[model samples]
Target: MTSETYPVDATNRVKRRHDRGRYDHATVHALLDAAALCHVAYVVDGQPYCTPTLFWREGTHLYWHGSSASRMLRNQSDGQPACLTVTHLDSLVLARCGFNHSADYRSVMAFGRARLVEEPGETARALTMMVDRFFPGRTATLRPSTGQEIKATAVVVMEIERASAKIRAKGVADDEEDYALPIYAERLPMRTLIGAPEPCPRLAGDVARPENLAAYREGRALEDALADAYRTAYP
Candidate 1:
């Protein structure tokens, strides 16, 4: 989408290479849905710290969990400004020249305030959402979260006031003169590799694969079928 179609507010500015930027809900949500981890940055006593954490998205909001005693969560619960970034590396473009080397990636940056969700039921729901975000139908099959487990966890909800997405996906761009140079150059791809599924040692030798584990059996991309499996098995 063009920048005019996806307007940016005071908080989210489309800086540098504005042509490659997007602010629409569809662009941002797509990147968020495909990602599992996010790097959260915040200021503490004039210093900045970026902590990596597991995250999930619900419409225009993002939820992340931390220990109840974590300093980041404690400060965020006090109503501090936070910046969350989610990124997916698609591939690496190895050019003939070092300066031309680059990576194909999609990323989203959100700016907003974070607050704690202390309610018992809401906290449990957030945890379940987190689980479903990664492995669909896992929460239902696993044992329910205990009360002590809920109490020990801290959930932070961030309203996406301003956000933008950046994407770079293409083959190597070589200068007209460089094309005649004697060098091998191309895009060497990288992807998530899944190995053969190994069963637990305690399972019976004759036990067959469960329906929920069929995705792994076919060697499919985790992001492609996770949500659908969750909806089918849990609904």
Candidate 2:
């Protein structure tokens, strides 16, 4: 059975302002599912690198893909240690003092060993899941990937060993004395809003937008749309 919370070890223990840290699977998974982009940090030949890419979660594992010739993918193909992180900025807090000014955000850092998914079947399935992750039911509307296309794509899966989530979603946290100052203090919420879908100009007029993408309509919050897509795909 999987533990309800990830173990708090030296690798994942929160040191500063530990009250903001969360170890529960619910918190970690929710944050991961709400975002599509992540940074994978790894060391190669004494050099540190962090590559930003699109990723998806499946149970305890995180999956990402890139060109088979990608240096980042090749380096991580041999079960190399990696740290994946995701951050979602929620608001900008303008405090009375410069030191007190901080942004609200939800972030997660997961440690794992990334290895290439070499199996043909598994790689194909992972790719399909990646597409359906944001456009549920749309995969079935498309043609199957050619063998060459599949071979050119490299899929990597990392089983999260330990993870920690830190979130600050509250308002301005100014000092008592600073709060009493005349300086203005407020929280400006931030949002990633979707815009109207622009269909391909060369497409036939008969082609209409798929119903599965209705959740991604204009003015919708990106995080909310992604979360909805995840639930629609998995639920």
Candidate 3:
């Protein structure tokens, strides 16, 4: 069985609405994997910055990349403390009163110190892993990245020192007495959808759709489709 909880420190503690807090690794990873983008918060020269970037998980580490000259990447590469957050909005929840309105979402907040991944071999591998995580078997079909391209990029990873997930997946909630209100109270569910792929105008041959992308074209949720494709890919 998978572990039920992750160690939470003062930084990772969820003080408000504690009922929605989940400390398990599964919950954190689930929220992280479901989203492709994350906002990384850190301090630079005592001024705070929250830079949005694309990130991916590999084993126990979370990795993100950027231009080597990026200030955010340069600051964090030296082991600066940071917080990474991934959130997916699930719905607009309407309640009987404006004060009780809320949104359904799955979100994870992780605290950690960053590490610069400088080794050429590891850097290359990290790039490949991210590609495969988002598009299974895609790395094999594409040409290997040259050393120059790799050198131009900076890959930094974090150990995920402590993390917690806050989830609100249910419908609207309101006070008992408010249920008698005359206004219509409802929940509007939301989703991130993938549309059919458009082919390139400079096409050479008849390129068939990859099985993984085909599922996405059929309207499967991005995370669910990726999971299904990866499971079948290895088996």
Candidate 4:
């Protein structure tokens, strides 16, 4: 089904106007694809626990891995609802007053039932997808995941049926009366910065920077462009 056809249920706790919310698959997947980290919230004994984890997408399913003994995974596998959220902070907007300070960001929150992937091949593929999602080409350079490694890890799959994307971006809004206030108002943009690439101390002689590092040279502003470059260069 197309993203427009994906069902959207009211899952946002804040409920800021419904118009800003979106249910399309494109909106949901785009937010997931832009970042590698997600905050997973689940309930255990009536209390909520939110843990940050690395995640990846395949078709409409979201998969994350954890230690086989992880409490979060165990709880979800035992039958509980979970919420996964992915967010990218693009900038910070500062207005004349503290109340006007805000962040420009894109975030997606998904509610789904989590299941444990018990099949050996499926588990291995999930792990491989996770690695490649983060490092792109590193999967080929690293040793293959062994049976022991798979056994030591746990993979959870969440089928997203109800989800929404909320975004607040750029500029400042001030009350008409407050606009004349003496306080200065302006947006202090924020961005990701990539430091010079560091190499392993054990590596011999002057090793050149890897092609993967090229996209991160300037951080977030160039992230989209870098991603295109990475896909072109690596794929």
List the RMSD of every prediction in angstroms.
Answer: 3.4, 1.1, 2.3, 2.9
Error of 3 at 90 (Å): 1.1
Q: After aligning candidate 2 to the native by TM-score, how far in Å is the CA of 175 from where it should be?
A: 1.5
Judged by whole-model lDDT over C-alpha atoms, candidate 3 comes out at 0.81
Candidate 2's C-alpha runs over 4 A off are none
Using lDDT, give the best candidate's number: 2
What C-alpha lDDT, on a 0 to 100 scale, does residue 167 get in candidate 1? 85
Question: How well does each candidate superpose onto the true structure, as a TM-score?
Answer: 0.85, 0.97, 0.91, 0.86
Q: RMSD in angstroms, candidate 1? A: 3.4
lDDT of 4: 0.75
lDDT per model vs. reference:
0.78, 0.91, 0.81, 0.75
Error of 1 at 146 (Å): 2.5
* Clashing pairs counted in every model: 0, 0, 0, 1
Error of 1 at 130 (Å): 2.2
Q: Please write out the lDDT profile of model 3 over residues 1-235, one tens digit for every residue.
A: 2356778768888889889999988778767776778999999989999999988875457898888889889898779999999888899999988898999998999888997798878987888866776777788988788878877888889988788999897788999888888889899988877776787877768877676556567466776765554454434
Q: Ten residues in a row with the worst lDDT in model 2?
A: 174-183
lDDT of 3 at 120: 71
* Candidate 1 per-residue lDDT over residues 67-129, each given as its tens digit: 988988988986689999987778888777888888888899998899998787888788887
Best by TM-score: 2
